[model samples]
Target: MTTGQMARAAEAPYYYVPPHSIYPIRGSLSMLATLLGAALWVNDFTVGPYLCIAGIISMLVTLYGWFGDAIGESEGGLNSKRIDVSYRWSMTWFIFSEVMFFSAFFGALWYTREVSTPWLSTLDSQTLLWPGFAGTWPNLGPAGTIAPFKTVSPFWLPTINTALLLSSAAAVTVAHHALRAANRSRTIFWLGLGILLGFAFVACQAYEYHEAYTELNLRFTSGAFGALFFMLTGFHGFHVIIGATVLSVIWWRVVRGDFTATHHFGFEGAAWYWHFVDVVWLGLYVFVYWM
Candidate 1:
C-alpha cells in the first residue's frame, strides 16, 4: 500500500471493530460496586470492602482484555506515524486539562490566602458587609474551627520526606540520561533507586499525617488552614502515588525491553509526570508547608 493509504487506513483503527458490549452497563455496575465500597469504607460497613474488591477486579479484567486487544493491534503493524502523532496530541491535551484542573484548586487557595482575607478585613465603609468577621487565610471560619489548627513541624520527618523526594527525582533524571546513553545497567540501577526513594517518600508522608492528626491537631475540620493544607498536600500526595505507579510500570516494561533511546515514549511520558509531581511538591513545600 502507498504510505498515504496506509496512513489513512491506520487512522480508522476503531472503525473496523464490531460493537460487542454496552459500556453503560459495565460502567454502571462497576460504579455501583465502587460506590458501595466507598460508602462502606466511610461508614465502616462490612460489605463495602467486598463490593469495592469485586468492582476493582472486574474493571481490571476489562482493562486487561481491552488493552490486550490494543497491544495485539499495535504489534500487528496497524499503527502508523500519523496515529502516533495523534496519540501524542491527545495525551498532551489530556495533561493540559489536568494541569488546569489543578490550577483551579491552586487559584482558590491563593485567593483565600492573599486577596480574600485582606478584603474581608478591609476597614472600608463596606466593612459592615462582614460585621465582626475576622479575616484569615490558612485559619478560616469561626474563631478557631471545627477542631483546631496546629502548624505542622517541617523540622523532622517532613524534612526527611522532602529530601527523599528530591533525591528520587534526581535519581530518575540520572536514569533518564543513562537511558539516553543506552547504558542499560546504570539506567536500571538508577530507576530502581528512584522507585525505592519514591516509596520512602510516601511512607514518610503517611507518618507525617499521623503525627499531624494525632498530636498536632492539624486536620481538615480546622477551616481554611487545614482545608488548604490537606487539599494541596493531599492531592500532591495522590499525584505521587500515581507517579510511583507509572514508574513501576515503566520499570517492568524496561525489563521486558519495551523501551529504547528512539522509542521510549512511555518512559518519557511517565518521567514528565513524575518530574511535574516533584515540581509541584517543591512549590507546596515552600508555599504550603513552609511559607
Candidate 2:
C-alpha cells in the first residue's frame, strides 16, 4: 500500500465490536415463546393468546434495545468507512435472501397453477382417484371440500395500493436526492411523505382484508389460492411496516443532523430496503392480484 493510504488506514477508527450481551438469547427465547404460544392457541389453549402477546412484547423490547445500541454507536461516530461498507454488504445479502424467500412462494403459486393442477386433472387420476375435478387455475378440491369463495381482484383497493407504493418509491428517491444535496428540510419532507404513504397503504390493505373476509368470503382457509394470497400479501405488508419503521428512524436521525451530504449510509440503507419492498409489492400486484 502507498504511504499516505497506510497512514490513513492506521488512523481510521478501529472496528467497533459490541460487548457480549443477552439480547440474542432474549430474542430467541421470545420467538420460542411466540411459536409455542401459537401452537397452543391453535389447539384452543386458554393461556396461549396471553403468552403470545407477552412474547411479542418481549421481542419488541429486545429489538428496541438492540437497535438502539447500534444507533447510539453510529451517532457517536464510532462507525468507520469500513463499518459502513460492511453494513451495505449486509443489507444487500439480506435483501437477496428475502428475494429467494418470496421466489419460493411464487414458485409454489406457479407450479400449482401451471403444472400440478393440470397434471392432476389427467385421465387416470380424474376418473379413478378423483372424479369431476376440473383442471382450473384454482381448483376447489374435488368439489364440496372447500367452501365457495371469491378471489381478490386487482380492483380499486389493490390498484390504489399499487399507486401508494409507487408514489412512496418516488418520494423516497426524491428524499435520497435531497439528502445527497445536504438539504435536511427537503429530505425530511419527502421522507415523511414516503412514510405517510406507506402507512396509508397499510391502512388500505387492512380495509381490503376486512372486505375480503366480510364480503368476499376469502380467507386463509379458503384454498390454495387463499393460502398463497394471504402468504404473499401478508408477508409483503409486514415488510412494508418494517421498511417504514426503518425510514422513520432515519428521518428522525436526519432531523437531528446525524448525517451529512457524504456520510448517510443509514438513510441509504433504509431507502434500499424501502425500494426492495416497493419492488416486491409490484411483483405481488402483477402475480397475486392481476394474474
Candidate 3:
C-alpha cells in the first residue's frame, strides 16, 4: 500500500456514520399521545389527563436517552468537520423555519386589521348584516357575544418583559464571547444570568396574562383582538420557555467541561435559538403592544 494510504488507515475513520435509531418513531408516538390526550382532556374525558401525563413523561424520557447518545457520540470524537458543518446548516434552516412560522401569524394580524376590517366597514350590507356594528379594530362581533374586554397596553409588564428579554440576549451574547475566548467560568456565569433573565420574562408574562384575564376581561374568546393577542404572545412565551430550557442544558454541559473554544456547536445552537426568541419578542412588543 502507499505510505499515505497506510497512514490514513492507521488513523480513525474520517467520517462517523450513525446507526439507524427508533428515536423518531418514539418521539412521534409520544407527540400523538400528548395531542390526543390534550384534545380528550379539553373535552372532559376521564382518562385524558392521565394519558397526557404519561405521554409527557415518555417524551421526556426519550429525549433524555436520545441526548445522552448524542453527547456520547460528540465527546467520543465521532463527529468530523463535515458533521459539524452539517449541524450548523441544520440549525440555520431550523431557525429560518421558525421565522416563517411567526411571519404567518403576523401576516394574519395585519390582514385582519388593515384589510378585512376596512373592507367590511365600507360594505353597504354591513349595516343590515349587523346593526350598530362598527368595523373598528378590536371589535366584539356584531351580535355582542363577546364581553367588553380591554386591550393590554404597552406600559408596565410588557415593557418589563421586553427589557428582560433584551437583557437576556445581551447576556447570552456575552456568554458566547466568553466561551469563544476559552473562559469557561465567565461563560457559565453569564449563561446562568441569561437563564435567570429568561425565567423573569416568563414570570412577567404570566402576571400580564393574569391581569388581562382577571382585571381587563381580555381572553382567548373575547374577539379577533383577543385571539390574536393571546395566540401571538402565548406562542412566543412557549418559545421562551423552550429556549430557557435549552440554555440551561447547555450551561450544565459547560459546567461539565463538555465544550471548548473551537468545538462547541451545541452551545452555539442553543444561543442562536435564544437570540431568535429575543428577536421575536421584540417584534411582538412593537406590533402587538405598541401598535
Query: In lDDT terms, which candidate is top?
Result: 3
Computed on alpha carbons, the lDDT of every model, listed in order, comes to 0.75, 0.88, 0.89
What TM-score does prediction 1 earn? 0.79
Model 1: residue 130 alpha-carbon error in angstroms = 6.5
Candidate 2 per-residue C-alpha lDDT over 18-96 given as tens digits, one digit per residue, 9 for 90 to 100: 7898999999999999999988999999999999989999999999999888877766656667877788999999999
Global Cα lDDT for candidate 1: 0.75
Provide the clashing-pair count of each candidate structure: 2, 0, 0
What shift in Å separates residue 266 of candidate 3 from its native position after superposition? 0.6
Angstrom error of the Cα, residue 81, model 3: value is 0.8
Give stretches of model 2 more than 4 Å off.
1-13
Cα misplacement distance, residue 40 of candidate 2 (Å): 1.6
Question: How many angstroms is residue 110 displaced in model 3 relative to the true structure, after the best TM-score fit?
Answer: 0.9
All candidates in order of lDDT, best leading:
3, 2, 1
lDDT of 1 by residue, 87-151 (tens): 57876787777688777777887888898777877777235665555665555464433565578
RMSD of each: 4.7, 3.6, 4.0
List the pairs of residues colliding in candidate 1: 138-225, 140-224
lDDT of 3 by residue, 151-251 (tens): 99999889989999999999999999999999999999999999999999999999999999999999999888999999999999999999999899999
- Identify the superior model by TM-score, candidate 1 or candidate 3: 3
